[model samples]
Target: MLNIVEGVRQYAKTDRLAVICGEESISYADVEKYSNILGNYLIDKFNSDIPTVIYGNKDVMILVAMIGSLKSGKAYVPIDTSSPAQRMKDIIETVQPEVIFNLSDKEIMLDSSVSKNVEILDKATLMNLMIEKSNTYDFEISREKWVDNDENSYILFTSGTTGKPKGVQISTYNLDSFSEWISPVLGIDGSEMVVLDQPSYSFDLSVSTLYPGIIFGATLFSIPNSLILDFKKLYAELKKSNIKVWVSTPSFANMCLNDETFSQELLPELETMLFIGEVLPVPVAKELLDRFPRIKIINGYGPTEATVGISQVSINREHINANKSLPVGIPMPNSVIKIVNDEMEEVPKGEKGEIVIVGPSVSKGYYKNPEITNKSFYVEGESIFKEKSPVSALDEKLRLRAYKTGDLGSIDDDGNIRFFGRKDFQIKLNGYRIEIEDIENNLRKINEISSAVVLPINKNGEVSHLKAIVVLKKGINESKLKKTVEIKRELSKLIPKYMIPRSFDFIDEMPLNTNGKIDRKKLYADIVEEA
Candidate 1:
């Protein structure tokens, strides 16, 4: 963590570029200067230790706010602008922030719904921090409160299977563990390398790029949501980006691979591509190898509970020939990836079991939600199962923490770990981790809906999209298309746009199995048969 702060300082001294978003760019000096100014502003109004919600998409200003909040000893909670107002309200309720930074130029009206005495640093106000007293802020005072060690650096809210959002609290130690380990692994050597920043700050995937890029003094070429929505602009950005390191999900890479222009010729300087947040299909790996033979392709795996990632595998011709599916690879030196049974006993190398990650990188746990945190996370000696069968006794961080990822996996005798998806109703579609039950829970809340079952429509070994099996109330009179539109519009009020099903099947009644529960298998079969 100290290295991270020093890295920023060194880069600022060098006057190198830190972030680039389309036409806008923020240099290291400005990022440091503005963040210090903003940090000083934050220290005046609120407790330095509380989390502050930062609302925006992919703008350079977002980075300044993040660094500033960290400098002021407050963890920044990122909420994307595309997020539903209800979702935003849920986060505000969870974090109970005293201040919210509206980094974008637009206004976010939370006037009527939320009742709180929250201070908002709107765009103009934030700009004023840079304008009014940019040269006279107490940089040393903000630096004195820099977030470190066990203190939460950032709180990322992700989809909860219980229908609420879970804020995973990654501490400065956790971020430091991740960034330090991945830098050398990715072969970043403090050079002026350009890395791609595709994911939003709200998502942990972006942390892999943003933090490491910052700490390593690498230039980040940010692709905002607006440019991503327009292929012409997205490709245009790519053509111009002298990207040496590519970090994005397989879904985003697949989008780029769909166009013939996304090849070595388009990004001649590109050398490393890292993928996570979803399954990396073999076809994508094969195509990338064929197109850019000189580039290195790596697939990483871990949950938000354990920093950005804990394990990684660099793919090659042998891996392509030897395996049907890719492995997430071995654990980092600072962590241990174990396959454990329901009893929490270590499963034999070749046997399938729950993937458990233990290390310093594991998050402090979900913020303010002790019930769920106790269920999913645990300290090493705290668990009877873990105490009975301890993993590596000499391991330094063994006593720190461990996260029980509900993901199924198996490790070979050689220490390579392979993933077999989740043990619950959660799925990743289009690079977004989603809980199907969360959508189902929200759907049942709609007055017109009786019951809903959300299913991932699988295509070519990956989820193509989501389909909802819904049953309306007894006398709701509307066409299927009209009802779908209406239902979607209502959903827009309850959840993020990504969680909404791409297609809907309005059914008179949901199929039932021998048990009283709705038969998801039957509905899935019926849908697949129809297609």
Candidate 2:
């Protein structure tokens, strides 16, 4: 179970730098040394399965804390300190962690009844402890003494836009499967100076930023949260390093492409631009490909349950047309993808339905909620006089658990999956059924537009209207654009009449969530209050 960390310790004997944060860089030997000290401290402080929370920005201390907690046979819950205070409080209360690890000394008031005994340790104290015990402890956890694969390694909470956030428990097996498949898929070797810009406590992307770097002896670059939105500063800082891979959300990719100077200078060195989390818009895809022809732009897809991404597709000029979206391509080797309807029946080729993923990379279940855990996650037909599944049986086709991704999709005859909007997000209006994304896609497909978002308006038990917010290309004017109402006429040919937005509001920019997702709720509020 802890073989991942053990591998790092073994690989540390060579002359290599393991982690590279802002001003400080640590060698592989130092990583092993620091992690040993921290792991020992954690083992001494808490008994097995005691909950813990790691706070603050991505740094060596955060990495050590994660590894240390896992080494002590406990699941570490990651709380993004940047999240709303109310949300953070709710998570801390629910988890009831024994310790709160913070690098920035961020304080949170806890309820006395359940969480009064929580211990707080800032980054300075951790670093001082590491220095004080420098390379002193000889830690040993042999392969013979392996912890069970079922033991949870980390609990990552998803943003609960639909309900209160639930912690998704990912085990050592999930990490191993992901690292095995994804590392080779990206052609990750040890030499690349990959930037760890994504928050460390986030899903598999955080794992992607860390594990592969350690496995290959590559230098991991850490970016502070404060610097993510400062595009100029970020690009300038990135230019200083010979970074080969740039991993981030599509919005960040769009931002970099929009900056003319960054496109001309900094992007040349970036060999792989990996976009995950949201739909990889065609406009941004085209711009990235046009500017950096040599760079491989991979559009990968998966929910948190799939351990980062289970499928990947690389975008090229010939494959994409003006009218179509790039398919998310094929499943990664060892992953089985099925597009099924409500009846759990498979959909035919080219027909869209819910995407259900079954693979070794899938997580166990939600933490401490058996009702959800049982309903959503289960080993089918296994309870009928069955034996335990062997590690070698990962590829064996038996009745195993599958994650019902609420995401809607269809696999073409060629096995490429095309993503539609979410099953919940789709709407029907008047006499016509519609996908809001279809309308938004048509609006942005026009050469005159740069960005577009579609929202459905409901009033008293009826989906009565469709609203669109758009940003025009640099030279287009709203007055002249008003003459393009016929544009909707063209859009109606592609989408249903009800799907064509009745009203169009031009804007300078589309508002985005902190995670770089389109904040449709915010857009709706702005349109209602102002328009």
Candidate 3:
């Protein structure tokens, strides 16, 4: 597989556009030259592999900073511009880099408590550094200066339940492996293609498009966060984007699908739709198929620790027509997925268990966090499984580096993996264990319900009952008391009386986090406030 640097080197000879953000367009040669100049400057300044914190959104320079940091042999931590100062401060303290690349054109005011030892460089300073380096320094670095495959390529900070974010350290080897597996899945050839870029650099979901698009020399059509909120402008851009591959969370697509014009007519060249960061609801898949009959809708499943996705499968017409809950799909070529019970023993096929991934794509571990890393990542050998166990051969072949996904799933007869839900989402209420997704899935099956999220309502520190928040079908009367009663009645027939939500809250749409997944934390807070 061609590494990122090699891909850039090959593409740099051509004048094809590599990135398009708003009215700004950047070519492959410009990307190579600018990144190299910035990289050489970074090398001269830092002279170490300490990660540099890149603060910005969907700017072209954010990509430049990322490539520059990699060329300088340092991993980069991307902080979104919308993130609260406190969150940014926390990351600053955690990574504690010598330099911070502030790509935003506006000045970022930081607290006085922030370290003064760290130098902050904005757009002008960054340009000066590049120009200064270009005049005297050769853009190319010696081979020894290049980061090893085992060394970190980037550190993506993800939300932690403990009120801080944990950094997921993805190595060069991990990224290369992910690119190799996802390239074919994305149908990316060297031929020019426009890949949609929706998520910000901070979110690992962006990695899904950024690396592969760069490697294939495809132009990335980036949609800024501000434009995403304005549907009128967003669709207008989509019509002109000529986007071939649509990469986003299912929620984003569902939002776009609300308009009648979001069909193939708007983007005739659109061939592939890749959904990740959450379960692809059956209704969303069915609608996409209805609108874009020839489009390939692939459902991918993985956490940040697993380098974007480890399992994926294309949603076919059969899956939409027949399956109640769509399967996440088979494991990627470089990865091995096993469903195991509490004791880490492989569960019987078709039985629900925690999803454990063992493979090349698995990240090294959380950066500078051995305790949390040890809890989630490990190695399993012969002693952990029976001699003739089904996974024993895979363990031998793959060397058994594993990550406990904390997600519950099971493999079906056809080798397709079905996601049950998060293990933590399972709650015990009134002496019964229930999966939240089970209720959510059944709730979504109702014709009037467009999107549904189920959460356990806690009473006295225990799950006492279930609460549901649903987005009704566009024309449905959400405010009517009878509408909710009817929804509850329909849900009762699909689920047990006890499993039916105690109360239903109807909304126009579900809240989405930066990564485009349903923002359950925000929803839970809303539920708490209502209670």
- Candidates in order, TM-scores: namely 0.94, 0.76, 0.79
Write one digit per residue (lDDT tens) for candidate 1, span 1-531: 334665677799887899998888999988888887888878776755888899988888888888888888899999998888878888888787888898765676664435467888887788876888766774654355888777898999999877789899988878877888888777677899899988988988998888888998999899888888899888888999999999899888888888998899999999899988888999889999998888999998988889888899899988888868888888887567778999999988899999998787898789998898999888776442343345444234433588999989999777888888777788888778899999999999999899899998888766788999888887457688888899999999989998999999888898888888899999988987998
lDDT of 2 by residue, 32-73 (tens): 767677666666766557667887766766767776676667
Instruction: Give the candidate number with the greatest lDDT.
Output: 1
Off by over 4 Å in 2: 1-3, 133-138, 143-148, 161-163, 381-399, 425-531
User: Candidate 1 clashing pairs?
Assistant: none
lDDT of 2 at 367: 78
Model 2 Cα shift for residue 490 (angstroms): 42
Model 3 Cα RMSD, Å? 11.2
Worst 10 residues of 2 by lDDT: 380-389
Report residue 321 deviation for candidate 2 (angstroms).
2.7
lDDT of each prediction vs. the true structure? Answer: 0.84, 0.68, 0.80
Model 1 residue runs over 4 Å out of place are 1-3, 111-116, 142-144, 382-399
Q: Judged by lDDT relative to the true structure, which candidate is superior, 1 or 2?
A: 1
Full-model lDDT, candidate 1:
0.84
Query: Model 3, 295-356: lDDT tens per residue?
Result: 99999888788888888899998898885788888987546788999999998999999999
lDDT value, candidate 3, whole model: 0.80
